[model samples]
Target: MQIPEFSKEQSALLARFLAEQKDALSLAQTHGYLFAVICAPEPLDVHQWLEQVVPGCDGQMDEQVLFAFMALYQQISEHVFETGYSLPVSLQFNSAQQPYLDMQECQHWSQGFMLGAQGYIAKLLAAPQLASELKEALETAQQSLCFFILDSADIASIANQHGLTEGLLCQQQYEVMNEFAAGFAELIEAVAVNSQLYNDEGWG
Candidate 1:
């Protein structure tokens, strides 16, 4: 059997993506847990630092959007695992989302993680000024989102332990993330317009 070979660029990007995702997951799961406790506002600081290291981060992506997505994703994750809400939309997939998919426990954590991944991929492929910036953004955003996940999981653990209710926290996060995803949404739209124009000599 042969392992498929990717272009050097693809391999590099994938390697970075995997490494970043690993860091993100670890941070998310353990950051705020009671037994395996995790803490810090450093996660947010880390995001700010990522913006400095990665130029065009704000232009290409929105921090608020990322926050919302993570929040929603974390909620979806808890609900799904605890039999809260199970919609196909909650379990949907795209090429950019696969890396964050976690089945051992919380699926929404993975989903939330991939939400950013999808946006990162779109930016990397489309924005020359932002290529390197995105690399760092992915790394930083992964950390912050993980921390966000950790916090949510901590709350859920308590809720589960004490028999409490989970509310619209995740829905709010999803709305925010969707707003952020709109950045990639626009990028995708631009790519489509450009491709169409080039194909038929209709540049506008």
Candidate 2:
């Protein structure tokens, strides 16, 4: 089925609306959250995830605004289903005139993704019947994404686990962005292939 794409103007409007919302996820964060929702082993309810994306949206959202947000959600979900992990990460030029991802934007995006993924990932990994190799793959993928989202202490821990010194990870932020995108693709592929196995009673 061909879905209408969320145009740049609509995205701008959504960003403006979100800015007016108290504690609402930023546009980048919303995109990240939607991406995670699509990759989840089981789907999350639209209303529930909408609430997460825009706190108190159900109680007070304007109808047009709500419709636009829902369209945004549907577009991202469809993109993931069709294209796997095409991360909507923004890039900027460094001092040497080299292009690299905007780390701050990546951080916000990853933060949103982590929030959406936490419960689903925990449940997926905790399944007693899950295979060891797949489990390891998921853990690694999670860690790669976590590097951008975690607190200083947790980020340090991951860096240390990989035999890197403190703060060294930030030195290669662009490389980590590539790793994050690769990991997300891996996760989407893994979950897509094994989706039926995860569609248990409560999740359905």
Model 2 C-alpha lDDT per residue in residues 1-204, reported as the tens digit of each score = 443567787788888998888899998898878777867766678788888988887745776676677778777766655654455775567798766656667788778888888887887777666677877877777776656776778768867888885445654654665555545645655654554344445352
Looking at model 1, the pairs that clash are 28-146, 31-38, 68-173
- Superposed on all Cα atoms, the candidates' RMSDs to the truth, in angstroms, are 17.5, 3.9
Candidate 2's error at 127, in angstroms? 1.4
Instruction: Give candidate 2's error at residue 27 in angstroms.
Output: 1.2
**Model 1 shows how many backbone clashes?**
3
Off by over 4 Å in 1: 1-128, 131-151, 154-166, 188-204
* Index of the highest-lDDT prediction: 2
lDDT of each: 0.35, 0.71
